[model samples]
Target: MNSIPFDIVGFDLDGTLIDTSGDLAAAVNHAIGTIGRDPFPAADIHPFVGKGARVMLQRALDASGGYDDAMLSALLPILLDHYAQNLAIYSTPYPGAVQALDALAARGVRIALCTNKAERFTIPLMQQIGLHDRFASIVSGDTVGVSKPDPAPIRAMIERAGGGRAIFVGDTINDIAGARNAGIANIAVGFGFLDGPVEQLQADAVIAHFDELVPLLERWPG
Candidate 1:
């Protein structure tokens, strides 16, 4: 088999590898409903993700009524519990994601996960989707003292994946900036949750679908 350009390929969890907006929105609504707030549509919740659950809940709360530290503290666990119970009810891999993973593995590439989602949620969610075993390493926000955009977690992801030249694929500013800060190449997905246009993320390249990932990586100059 021909050698691949990258030994390790790391990916962000939400909005990158999987379309988790449905369940995430449900969880947010569940939490906000406790305070008698109306539920937000999944589409509206998409952009609020990628930062982590607390922030997502905060954004939703801020939009609906208002939020305070006490409300956040009381609602976080409830949100988490609701999400954990409904992890895979609406979550699924993005189109061609599994095929892309298989293609990368076929080329002897090691797949890794570097997500801002905390381990408590990330692990269970991946397991629920039957994808936990696919990654050589899973680095969640809580794995390192800090998360994406800090570079430390990305570095930790590389190290835990057994170390080698690596590239990251993600859909948010944190993901792209994290990879850049870690001094690695990054690819942004156009299909992911974004606050603005995919092009504005300024990744090394942008892929509209997972089917394009392997070929793009193979030809990447880095």
Candidate 2:
């Protein structure tokens, strides 16, 4: 059994906190089209969600299956620019997300969002969705020297949250790895951008819905 009663909760933005896949897909397909390649649908690019823009572009191009590195390099900035223009146009928080954040806050849990996305995009999206003030701290890819799956960002969040007990919630293998690397337990949710069952990520616990987090976190041992 995993322990809980965490005083702080760190969340992953793109996949766990918000579903920005629609806008991301729009941008990616725009890049593909600009290069005269076939555009892939949103569903086909789910696995590429959590990482930053550069990595996502690489994954999308890799998925296209015919692009060379030179081709990817040439198309990335265009895709990023397009993505920035459409950020949050249709992007919104996952169902029950705000309620879950509120519940955790009521229980005295500090909330932080630690993402590989650069601050330029991360902050704006949070503001657009009215969740900018919800987080005690926001650590973006540009905030630290290293990103997730390396643990530095998570450590930064923990430090910002005042270093009590904490839990990291996300939907990707990178989040799981980062949480473990930071010495915090993690709960992987299945309702987001993961390409497969969250169990495959080897998280301490797996939640199928946002509402379940209330019970899970409330029951954790301090």
Give the top-scoring candidate (lDDT).
1
TM-score of 1: 0.94
Candidate 1, residues 150-186: lDDT per residue as tens digits?
Answer: 9999999999999999999999999999999999999
**Which ten contiguous residues of candidate 1 have the minimum total lDDT?**
1-10
The C-alpha stretches of model 1 lying farther than 4 A from their native spots are: none
Would you list the C-alpha lDDT of every candidate in the order shown? 0.92, 0.85
The all-Cα superposition gives candidate 1 an RMSD in Å to the true structure of 1.4
Clashes of 2: 3
For 105-203, candidate 2 gives per-residue lDDT tens digits of 777778998998888888888888899998988998879888989999999998986888888998888899999999999999898887787779999
Q: Cα deviation in Å at residue 160, candidate 1? A: 1.5
RMSD of 2: 2.7
